[model samples]
Target: MRRFNLKEFRSERNLTQKQLIAKTGIPNVTITQIENGHKSLSKELRKRIFDAFQVDERLYVA
Candidate 1:
């Protein structure tokens, strides 16, 4: 599986962490931890994030 580049993804969409929190309903601290490599993504979080991005998950996986 390919690693998701959260920062790059947000940058490509012109999103601030707060904006992503608004869109994904993920907590700011959780997002911060994920970005800093201090936390791993749960499946539910991945689903929420991809849904917020409106992209097919298959595009991100091998």
Candidate 2:
């Protein structure tokens, strides 16, 4: 299965990391780590991201 690459998704939205944090309230460090492959998106944070984008969270799950 393909992992949900947050960086790609964020790029598609034309958003900067800081902008995403501001929009999702998920924190800059968390977004940075996730994007850098140094961290995984927790279930709660995953839900927040998908919900913020108004999409199905499952589609973005690893």
Q: Top model by lDDT, which number? A: 1
RMSD of each: 1.8, 1.6
Residue 30 Cα positional deviation in candidate 1, in Å, after optimal superposition: 0.1
* TM-scores for the candidates: 0.88, 0.84
Put down candidate 1 lDDT per residue, 1-62, tens digits, no spaces: 56677777788899999999999999999999988889887889888999977888777762
User: Candidate 1: where is the Cα deviation over 4 Å?
Assistant: none
Best by TM-score: 1
- The collision pairs in model 1 are none
Q: Which 10 residues in a row give candidate 2 its minimum summed lDDT?
A: 53-62
Residue pairs of candidate 2 with colliding backbone atoms? none
Report every candidate's CA lDDT: 0.86, 0.84
